[model samples]
Target chain A: MTTPLLEVTDLKIHFFTDEGVVKAVDGVDLTIERGKTLCLVGESGCGKSVTSRAFMQIIRKPGKLVDGSMLYRFKKDDGTDEIIDLAKLDPKGKPIRQIRGQEIAMIFQEPMTSLSLMHTVGQQITELIRLHTGATKHEARNRAIEMLQRVGIPKPDRLIDEYPFRLSGGMRQRAMIAMALSCNPTMLIADEPTTALDVTTQAQILDLMLELQNDYGMALLFITHDLGVVAEIADDVAVMYLGKIVERSDADTIFNNPKHPYTQALLRSIPKIAMQRDELEPIKGMVPSPFRRPVNICQFQPRCNQRFEACSRVEPVSTLINENHSVRCLLYEDVAAVHQADTEAVAHG
Target chain B: MWQYILRRFTYMIFTVWIISLITFAVIQLPPGDYVSTMVSQMINSGMDELPPDFEQEVRAQYGLDQPIYVQYYKWMRNIIRDGEFGYSWIYRRDAKDIMVERLPASFAISAFSVLFIWMIALPIGIYSAVKQYSLADYTFTLIGFIGLAVPNFLFALILLFISYKYMDQAMIGLYSQKYETAPWSLAKFWDLVKHLWIPVVIIGTSGTAGLIRTMRANLLDELNKPYVDTARSKGLSETTLLWRYPVRHALNPFISTIGWILPSLIAGELIVSIVLNLPTSGPVIFNSLMDQDMYVAAGFILILSTLTVLGTFISDLMLALLDPRIRLS
Candidate 1:
């Protein structure tokens, strides 16, 4: 295994509210190798989005990162090795600011809200270039024009000068992507980039991101709740539940042989295009609230169909089920016995 | 935008007419006749005792014996035809002429107060909000509350007392040392500004406090916006993040509120003028009411209403310019 480009260990983010402490992100462990894509898949309030925001240290007040560190390793221009803990950087200082757009860029969910409506689309992209790369205005403009063209915007020059509201939703998302990739970042964290977009635009943006990722060979931490998107772009996948990674494996393994019951449910929930279903079989019961501290092994026990007494009594540690696959479920432990029982039941039937 | 302005102008005219009619009716109604009140006051002070013909004399002098609608019609006719707002029974001058004469002084004082308030406010407000619970923020907040708590009149009185103690005389409001019936001159303007400081500062202090609190709340709200978070995530400097992003968006609310504050500032100045005894509109309007000077009070009300409407219009225009989303309609 090569050294991961980014490593997050034991991340615990909590919000101190009047009601109680909300464990928005608890004991989250994530890793991304260079030139690979990792998707964190979960429903809302499951801490997938929170984990993405933690990388940028943009958590607002009443929210504190109680425990954890995100380490980024990079090779310097002088050929020296550099490692920095993202959590400890002064949020206002130049070092973090320099690293933000230049080394690690992000594409947000709502393009309308994220893009400055006051500025021209072109001006915003150029301004970012000038700020991080010290490019002159002319140089920035030329680069912005190039980036806008690269993102498949028609009449890139005219579009650059146009305000955000004047553009279509797809154009705005592409513009956001153009701005994010303008600095040639080593890592791109896209938080639900296609949730607000139409299906056709979503497919376009997904294709664009894949093309850019292949071209740059940068690590991509794609955060989404859509299993379809995960299937489309992700090389490695991690399933998150109530702020913890429930399962991690390659995209193929997670789709074919889902080890965790929650992962299985998520797979089954995806509707097939061939079948014309009126409604989706949404997972039963709401995700357990993070108001109380999570105890025991399986947070999924309450909703799990395969649950037993031991599942509720003891917490399960992550057990390696195969190469490049690990799951935090009691069923995965001593799999030979479980497999034998399943085979015997099938034969009897 | 042009259509919007034209519509606003039409509305302004309608609003001014309504305001004028209200003033006219209030004065005409059963409280006291403008002419008889004057005659009765003179009669009460034993200056000269008039016979029963006194009412008749007053009625004939001002053409008040006419029907109420006819009287209003004549007044409106004169206002539209000659731009004459009739004559002030108390000041013995044309109402419109007196308003023109007094307007510059009131405007100068109000403009100065507004400028001073903004200059002192924006920085302090932004700083306090950014620092949130820090000691500097707490201190400024405490001072802001204290500033808001003190009445404008009391604040003027404190300054007056301080000036009296130091200068051995009443250092009053925005009047020159040679202000009594003096012609306009540079020396007089300079002296007026020197004296203007007390009233302007006092008038502006309370408003300054209110504005700081407003700006702080608005900017703090903008700070929490996801766009600001997006800007910060781009690795933009804090100053860049604030000025380039939230400040522009935050200013929209303040720009809109300026319309409301214009009226408050005028009311504030009225109090400051009375307490400090400067010959600004506040004193004139107050004295006119006390003496039941109908034409002078009515004329002043018309001017004040016009100013309030225009101030609001200007604020709306500024908001429209700053934020593209707001259409004129």
Candidate 2:
């Protein structure tokens, strides 16, 4: 009934290199409701990280958001809903800066390298707090200490003065989380934040993130290639291939009744308990290079086992199978056409 | 930290002692002493060969008749006890006085050249790295290569020619003719400043070019690091992000280079000083070595070695201060 926290429509990000333009993120659409998790699952170079970076307007040079509008909804001081198109704002201008860490914050993959070794963890945390909140030095310090404690770090007082290199990988990730959550942002974008951690530490970090998300009631955009993590944390799932999303649905539907062949292939690839190690089946073929994207056809057709004749000639648009599920595949075109006709007939009647 | 510094200082003293010993020995390695050179000069001028007693008397007067170790011990003891640097045979004065007189000018030129190098190289290097592969970056790379390829003395000559031909100004010495022998005064200082730029530019060229390449490469590497992106994601301004993160890391290498600057104060730009006719330590040392002026040459070199040790110690301390990882280790 209420508007989603953020709605991204037709997002396209291109990287212009000397060789050619790399359509790194082409036509990605996503929605994140308040207090829910959206896991973007994809293989490497599939543009999941790039899409999340676009939300923060932190895309590095050579890669640019060439099209799309990100409609972000937030409450003003007067308790009224206000909408802004994030894509239209100048990335380097003051408006985006004010909204960046305050409204939407991000955590990265490499905790060891994400925090600057030159500054104390306390200094890094307080810098963000003061930048957005305009808090006094003493206030920022106290807030940073409190945040460090909240992130489950022991002896926050002592660790505050320690440099990032002095902390373990999990502790560094925790510090990063504390810094991201310090501003009480409405949305958090985490790009494979646990990829570098061991299994135990990864699980701890995931639990901490879930607890924090529940407490803050913030929308989470979790990007990862790990299906196990997605199953554990994601309420909604979107499968990405190359630069396009192939399937999106509620987590249960995606796990139980995956519509797109790419999603099925990805599910089959995950190693299961009680199964032999050699029994795992990986998706066939390398992801086609971004420079040579398939023309006028489904991006996943080459990798799909059940691909039909129409898949090679027609690019599949997102087709709704039900109220809560959508897939981009030529197999579902007839269902989408029937649904469209029904909607049109009802509107006329 | 204090203990570390004290240990380093101790090592520095030992290093300086070894350097002094080596310098004294190397200076004495030539075939003859200053007295023999003087006798040869006198004989070449058509005088009859000096009597055997005359050469022995001259050698005894200069302490040259003593064993090499005894000569070294006496020189070192005199320097440690009374700050004396023995006697200059060529200038007929104390070596200390000659060094004190010429060293300030050399120090000024070297200090200003280092300042010039840092000031120009830092901003341009940061710019070149941030705008890598841009037209400006390419232009600076070209200029840096040219600076590094051309020798300092040759560059000095070219600058002198340019200034003479185009500006009609003979940019040759540290001061105009009037201020050459003038005592220390505001006017003499200003005249020195007016002529200081040429040598500063010449000496600083290669160092500046080298530092620019270093800084650009260092900063370019730092710029891609994940910490930079993390800082940017915090909504810091681009300039703030750049200066606070990558530039801070890039500056570590430059801090370590401060060690070499002290020795370069006396030894750098030797030919440039000779070509420009400046009254600096480089030419004085050169002439002293050529004439077998043992005390003056040894004293200058000893001071240069001591400075090098002190500079390295200072740079180590500065590096530890800048990087916490180094500090803890």
Candidate 3:
């Protein structure tokens, strides 16, 4: 098979605060292929946003990328494949900058604040286009206008001159998307881009993003806590809990046959139209504090109604039950032990 | 925009008129008028006694014998119709003349001090915020606190003593003894520039420190804004990202402060002016108010208030220009 567009291996980002270290993202593994969407599903403070930011190397101070390798595969001008380890490059250096907006662009959650109110929409979009493509003023302006039109902004000509505040919430987010896609990036990291919009606008934005994804054929890393959105758009779903992906597989398998207790609890908690308000089943407990994560045990054991004694005694490793389905739970420990033995035997041989 | 400006202008005129009324009333509020002070001075000068009607004649001559409202109406009429700010009792000249004589020097000194404050405060504030918690930031913070704590006049005296003792320079007044009464020439201007730094530094220190704190706080708040993150994600260099986005937003406070700066041009750093012995409106206003020189005191105050209103209008216009979120309407 051809190499994936981006491969993230054991990525760990820790924030060193005045209080002890916050393991915001610990040992996450993800892969995204060209023209596909990988939905990172997690609740607040579960490091989904942090993981996406690490892709652009825009993590703020006191947060350090402790360990990882992000191997990005792209085609050069000569049509030959080249690989670069993004984790090794300096965030402030020229090489990473060339890749940041041009190769892997990001759109943030708060569309209202993500675009500068002081600048016109055209200026912001043209600035990125010019920075990445070195296009002349006229070219950049035309490109920005085209981008705005592509994102379905009405009256792109007049809207280009307006500031972010002049636009509605949905339109502002559209502008942000236009700016991100202006450089024709190979990967797009969207961090809950529609969370701030109204329900109608959110649906429209999602459709727009899917249409754009199809047109651009870029690898889309869509981060959100909305399972409905995941069901609607995600081809591959990775359910994160307390900074760890407990279950990952194709969207159908994840929804139809969730293996991890956390994933099961999450799926069960979704309130259906037929259910009464009091009939909704929430997961048993709050996500454990990041500082005091459960050690030598399954991270979800405390909240798992089906948890067994072995869950508290041994940490569960990711075990492959079948092709395209992996879960981190002691319920699959028998399969994990066999897989571990097979890998060890091969290594020893 | 034109409509907005015109509206603000009208409001400014009304505000100035009200301020003038209050200033005139406050100047007259003290128990004695200028004539009483002059009479008291005459008695202290060893005049055994004056004619009983002498005081009345002097009072009538200056229109002080009239009722307060009548006097106010006359003062207002003179200002409106003839463009006169009444007469200065002590200076024995038009109140406008005294203001004109001292205003240029005052304006020059104040303008220089503001320039000094802005030029120094901006970069240091940016640096302190960008490199927050660095050694340089801490050092600047310490210096800024000291600057805020020390009174301007005391700092002025310290600078004066330092200049006199170590540099063998008197550093008092706006110009040297030779240029004390010298008319405006290139040489006089050059001499003024040479002596300008001492007063500029003295008057600017507290403001500079205050602005540094303001800028640092403002920039720190802006630095973490999501827009800044968006800018960084655009592959712009850190410096370019900072100056283009967050720094522009952080400058709102500085623009808003232009309102106070204009009035400060005439009346800022009053104690520092006295300590440094500069020829500025502060000391003139002080003396006039002390002796109840009604028109002189009232005139200076009225002009200062007008400037304040005009400055606020200008600042509002500038803020609208800078921030698109602020609609003039």
Candidate 4:
């Protein structure tokens, strides 16, 4: 199909701590097309947040992106397109900074604390606009108002003068979104934007995001643990187990016919409305610590219910089950041979 | 905000009343009256005891013959009647006169020390925190420890000795003998500035070191916050992120600290001012304490405690104003 807006190949980010090396984001490949939402679904510490940080080159001290190529494809003013490797550019250098907020802005998890307490919401939004676009203060402020209005915040003029703490959680998240989009970024990375919010507010924020996404045509790299949230907004879904992607497919395929045993277990664990009388099923075991991770094997082998000898000793290679569907599991090693067995297992169930 | 301040003021009055009681209790804690101290000092100064009835006359005049509660009641009544500070037994002067005479010099030194502390501590504190574990941070850390280790009076003596031996600077007082009684003039002002630094350094080194550690730790804590990364991701430069988010966030602690800082500065100066032989409240309080001048000593304590309460209120209000999160709450 068309060239993706961003194609990340074998991104390996590790943290060298006093205790041991944490293979936070290890050899994971992900892609986001222009104007599409790609959700990185995983449990906490499964490298989803680290991968998002790597995208912006914002990985903190002791954590280094040892190996990766994040090839960002974008259109220039002359209508010709260019490809830049975000991973290669110095994180704090000029080139990456020019691209970071101007072309790729990020929202954070905690709405209460994501914006600074010292500055007014307007000032923060104006700061982002000016930092990237070289706009004058007056121009930046006007643009900030426009963005705040666009984010569905009521009374943009008044809210502009208020600080983050003055607003409710939903309003704060909206303000955060407003700040992220102030520079008219081509990509928006949201790290669990609604996790700290209540249910009704979460739905509102998610709706606001979807509307904003449609308006801006911005590629959205949404990192979250909530599968339900993924089902609502994602265009492509990448399920991460430990530091690797266990499954990558279109949203429909991921939900309807999850391939990896890890994905199957995750999908089964989601509580359904009609199944209220039924007790919720949890995964059998805990995720292994980063220090205890086994080398040269599937990360989920120890926790996988459908483990075999090959799953333990042999490293699983990604196999394409069909168009736009792939799984890193020995169960799908030979998709053509296993295709019939998969259909039978599904049909029988 | 007005109502809150009013409430705080009411509470302050109540607290001051309680503090006055404590001051009275401590004043009465020692066994002898002011007459005994006068007698002893006279004897120490190579004079025989005053005429046999001299002690009885002095005690009767100062109402030292009254019980503790009666004395406390009378002191409180005199304070309320005309806002009059009581009589000083040692110098036979008004308590207000002593405070009025000493207040400006003591105030100037304290203000200078605060300014010096801020000016030196701020940039170094920011640097130490930002480039933590660097050579500069380590050096500043070592300096901070040394400054903290030396007692303020001892530090003043050390500084005085060093200046005497090497620089040959006579850091004796807030001003030279001429300016001591001279009217305000340009030359007098310049001389004050020249001698002003001695007490500033002597009193401020420990405060500066303490504040540096505070600013460094506070900034370091703010640095690790998630908003810092969020700001960076917004294309804000490293410097911008530092001052905009973390530095502004750090200003809260500094603002909150200004309350207690004044009293500590005053207390620190009380010791250093003596070491440097500065003409401030330290010597007056010292002489009053040694001679058992109860009214003068008690009056100074009351003024100091009132200043402390007032300083805390002002700082708390400032904190609320600077930080909207607290203001709204």
Question: Which residue pairs overlap in candidate 1's backbone?
Answer: A122-A160, A296-A315, A297-A315, A297-A316
In candidate 3, position A240 carries an lDDT of 87
Clashes of each: 4, 0, 0, 0
Interface RMSD per candidate: 1.2, 0.8, 0.7, 0.9
lDDT of 4: 0.87
TM of each candidate vs. truth: 0.91, 0.93, 0.95, 0.92
Taking chain A of candidate 2, what TM-score results?
Answer: 0.95
Please list the C-alpha lDDT of all candidates, in the order they appear: 0.84, 0.90, 0.88, 0.87
lDDT of 1 by residue, A214-262 (tens): 9988899999999999999899999999888989998999998898999
- In candidate 4, how many Å is residue A343 off? 31
Over 4 Å off in model 1, which ranges? A274-281, A333-349, B47-52, B68-70, B73-83, B133-138, B166-169, B176-187, B327-329
List the lowest-lDDT window of 10 residues for candidate 3 chain A: A337-346
True contacts kept of each: 0.67, 0.74, 0.83, 0.80
Kindly report the TM-score of the first chain in candidate 1. 0.92
Off by over 4 Å in 3: A335-349, B262-268
Best-matching candidate per TM-score: 3
* Chain B, per-candidate TM-score: 0.91, 0.95, 0.94, 0.92
DockQ of each: 0.66, 0.68, 0.74, 0.64
Can you rank all candidates by DockQ, best first?
A: 3, 2, 1, 4
Better of 1 and 3 by TM-score: 3
Please give, for residues B1-329, the per-residue lDDT of candidate 1 as tens digits. 87877777889889888988888787666566777677777879886857778788778778888887787778888878989888888888897878887777788888898888898888889998888779988888888888889988888889899889988768765664566568878878887888888878887888878788888899888888877877887888889789998888877888876766666777888988888877678778777777777778777887787778887888878877877666522
